[model samples]
Target: MSREFEIAREFEVDATPEQVWDAFTTGTGGWLWPMDAPEPREGGTGPFGSTVVTWDPPHRYTNRVANVEGIAEQTLNQLDYTIEPREGGRHAWVRYVHSGIFVEDWDNQYDGADKHTDFYLHTMREYLTHFAPRPVAFTTLDGPEASKAADALSTAVRGLGLAEDVPAGTTVEVRGPDKGLFPAVVDYHNPYFLGLRSDDALIRVFGRNHWGAPVGISVHDFAPGADAKADAAAWQRWLDEVFA
Candidate 1:
C-alpha cells in the first residue's frame, strides 16, 4: 500500500519576488543542484520531466511529475512555490510544498526528504542574500557504504574537526585535495545537516544515515571558471578518506 506525504515550509529571503523566481527557476546551481532550464508558462516542461501546472511569473510556479525513476515506489510527485513581495519589494516571502506518494519504505523516505528541504531552503536564502549575482558550479558525492552507520554523521563531523553541536558563525578550515585549507563559516547547523559558506562557495553536508541512506555532500562553487567534476572528485576523495 502506498502512503501520501506533504512537506510544507514557509520562509522569507532578503530578495525580491523576481529574484526569488529566478532562484527557484533558472538559477539552478545557486541554491540547488544544476539541471536543464525548465520551460516557462503553464503546460510547459518542468524539472524532472514534469508538467508546469501554474506559471504566474514572479509569483507562483508549480509542476507535477508522474512515475519518476530514482525514487523507489514513487507514484506522483508535485512541487509548488508561491512567492510574494515583502518589505516593499526588497524581500520575498516564499511558501513551498513538496507532496508525493510512496510505498513500503515510507517512513525512511519521508524522513530523508523532509529534513533535506530545510537545508536546501536555507541555502536558497544564503544565495539570495549573499551570492545572487555570481554563477554557480555545483556537484555532489555520496560517501561509501561505511557512511551508513548509526554514528556516521558524528564520524564525519569529527573527521572535519568540528564539534557535534557547533553553532552558527563558527569558522572551520577544511583541507582541499591539494592540502590547502579554505576557511568557511558555519552558516547553518542542525542534527541532520551542515551548511558552510565561504568567500566563493557554499557547502552542504547531509547526514542521511539517520534516514537509511549513505551520507552525502554537495558543493556549490561561485568562483570564476569553477569545475564541477573536479569539485566532486575532491569531495569524493575526502569522503573515502573520512570513512576509511
Candidate 2:
C-alpha cells in the first residue's frame, strides 16, 4: 500500500497580490529558485520537467512532479500556491502546500522538502519588497557535499564574516573569496538565509543543506544588460574557494 504526505506553509508579504502573481509568472529570475517558468495554462511544464495542473492569475497555481531528476522515486509530488490580497490591496497573503503519496521513508523525504521551502519563500519576499519591476537574472551555485545539517552549514557561512542577523535597510559589505568587495542593503536576514539588495543586483546566500552537505548560493542580478552566466561563474569560483 502507498502512503500519503502533505505540508502547508503560509507567509505574510509586504506587497500586493498582483505583484506576487507577477513574481510567480514573469519575475521568475527574481524568484522561483532559478527554475524555468511554467506556462500560464493547464498542462504547462515547469522546471525539472514538472507539469502544471492549475494556473489562475494572481490567485492560485499548482504544479505536479512525478519523476524527480537523479533520484529513485516511488511517489508523486504536488506543489500548490495560493495568493490573497490583504490590508485593502496594499499587501498580500501567500500559502504553499506540498502534498503527495510516498511508499517509504516518508519522514526523511518530507523533512528535506519542508526545509528548502522556507528558503524559497524568503527569496520571494526579498524580490517583492525591493527588486520588483527590475530586470533581474538569477544564478544558483552548489557546493560539493552531502547530507549536511543546518547548524554545521550555519557555522561555515558565519565564519566567512557574513552577518547572522541584520535589520532591513541596513547598509553592509562583504568580501567574496576573490577579495572583491560587494556592497548592498540588508533586505532580510534569518538564521540560515541572508538576502541583500543593491542598485546592481539582488544577492541571497543559503546555508541550508539541500541533498548532501552542500550549501547553495543564488545571485539575482538586476543591472541592465548584465551577463548572468558570467556572474554565475564568478560566484561559483567564490563558493568553491570558501567551501574548499
Least lDDT summed over 10 consecutive residues: which range in candidate 2? 146-155
Residue pairs that clash (backbone atoms under 3 angstroms), model 1: none
**Residue range 1-244, candidate 2, lDDT tens digits:** 4677888899889999999888876636777555677877899886577898998888998988885665564457788989999999999999989888766666666666676677678777877877787776778877655415546455444544565555667887767656777777776665556666777777777765633446777788888888878888887777666655
> Residue 125 in candidate 1 has what lDDT?
93
Number of the top-ranking candidate, with lDDT as the measure: 1
Error of 2 at 161 (Å): 2.5
RMSD to native, candidate 2 = 3.2
Q: What is candidate 2's TM-score against the reference?
A: 0.81
Write model 1 residue lDDT over 99-217, tens digit each, in one string: 98987688878887898898889999998888996988989889999999999988887777678888888988865554557898989888898888999999888999998789999
